[model samples]
Target: MSQDEPKAKETKRLVVIGGRGDRAAGTVWLVGAGPGDPELLTVKALKVLQTADVVVHDGLVSDEILDLAPSRARRISVAKRKSRHSYAQDDINRMLVAFAHDGLTVVRLKGGDPFIFGRGGEELEACREAGVACKVVPGVTSALAAAAGAGAPLTHRGSAQAVTFVTGHASTGQVPDLDWDSLAKANQTVVIYMGVSTAAGISARLIDAGRAASTPALIVENASRADERRIVTTLSGLPEAAAEVAGPALLIVGEAMALAQAGTAELVSHVEARGRERGAKS
Candidate 1:
């Protein structure tokens, strides 16, 4: 082939490659990493992680889960702790949009189900406003994990007819101004996320609103992890019990909690053994 002919063919190939890159650039996926267990990740979420060009993840997400992503993927830790945010919500939203615009397949990996208090709704809205194509993949929330790990059934036939998951903190970092009366009378299982710091206030409000002080309550700390801890107490004791919970924890309160007695003793013993093993390893 003549020199000019070869050059023309090469130029056409470059243009096609550039067009393909442009076509694949503007997509984002909001994926849930589940409650501290990499194995809990959904197949779709795992596939997305494999193809992601960039992953922006939360603080509660496990490192093992992040390792599922392709080695070449750019990982960004935008994890937020109590009053400590590595990246503000607005900034994270902007970053996702900006990354997609740059032709990166962005993944916003959050702990638990993204829509469950993960600020994923706000991020989804941001993506919509920016005209970015986004998809959400749900994961197992910590409430469910905590209940399962503690051998508590969130909904028992004759005990709990429903279950409610609530956040203890508001945007101002204060106990949310929830309807205590309704919550107390609901008769369903109530799971409070991020309530460790506000356990005392939560217990007082529930009692003031007519909830039985003797209602069964359980606090599961570092749930689904090797060193997980479960503390069984009553509604009245939640405040004191929570004070001793050192790591990330979830609180479950309701009559259904009594069902925990079925196998909770064994589960607690297992957790204690795991804790000892971890301590020995350390």
Candidate 2:
């Protein structure tokens, strides 16, 4: 039999396979579960979830989305927190390949667009090297949800002509080395993911690079979720604004952010406090 040829299964579920030579018996899909809201999940992702025999998902993926998978499917959580990983990247990759080799459909579900800092690329490489059939389903990244929930535009024709997404910390968990000169450019929006911890350094660097201290800034925490929060401030107050957030959040800086809603900072802080006290069920 040709290495790329798929052996068909007679189950009601339709297994979609992409032919690639020297592949394993089963297939692995990198599915994006989207930011928080189950409603935000793409139809294609929903279909893929329905057919999964084994699902390896990020810790942040909502419980509602996971409930969509078949009742008999095996679910594994690979949640990563600051300095704490439920499973190492190498281990996760091995699990996916091993599942596929057993002729099971595996779904490596991620909380945002898998390719958007979700380490989907690394998993994809691992699958290819293992000769496992792999495919991808993109999801709505948190940045877009953050902007929309705050009524801010990442790019506005009048105020912003460009948008840049950056991580605040490096893989080593230290402040990331970023180009302040370019990030300081006027008019373009800069969205920082996982930035709450490094807000002080990030704001200082941008200000030093000529970004106006008065530039508008927006912070969205637990974006798109029921416990979400939004804070609107100026570049000068970015760090202080971030101090109130205690969830997986994003920071947006640009003139376009001036249009965002901001009077709820105190109330949102209260809600977030209560949430933290109750603890996250997901």
Q: Model 2 off-target regions past 4 Å?
A: 1-24, 263-282
Q: Which stretches of candidate 1 lie over 4 Å from their true place?
A: 1-24, 261-282
lDDT of 1 by residue, 16-120 (tens): 343233555568899999988677788999998889877888877877888888887877777688888766677778778877877789889998999999888
Clashes of each: 2, 0
Q: Ten-residue segment with the worst summed lDDT in candidate 1?
A: 1-10
Each model's lDDT comes to 0.81, 0.85
Query: What lDDT score goes with residue 254 in model 1?
Result: 95
TM-score list, all predictions = 0.85, 0.85
Please write out the lDDT profile of model 2 over residues 153-226, one tens digit for every residue. Answer: 99999899999999998877766999999999999999999888999999999999999999999999887888
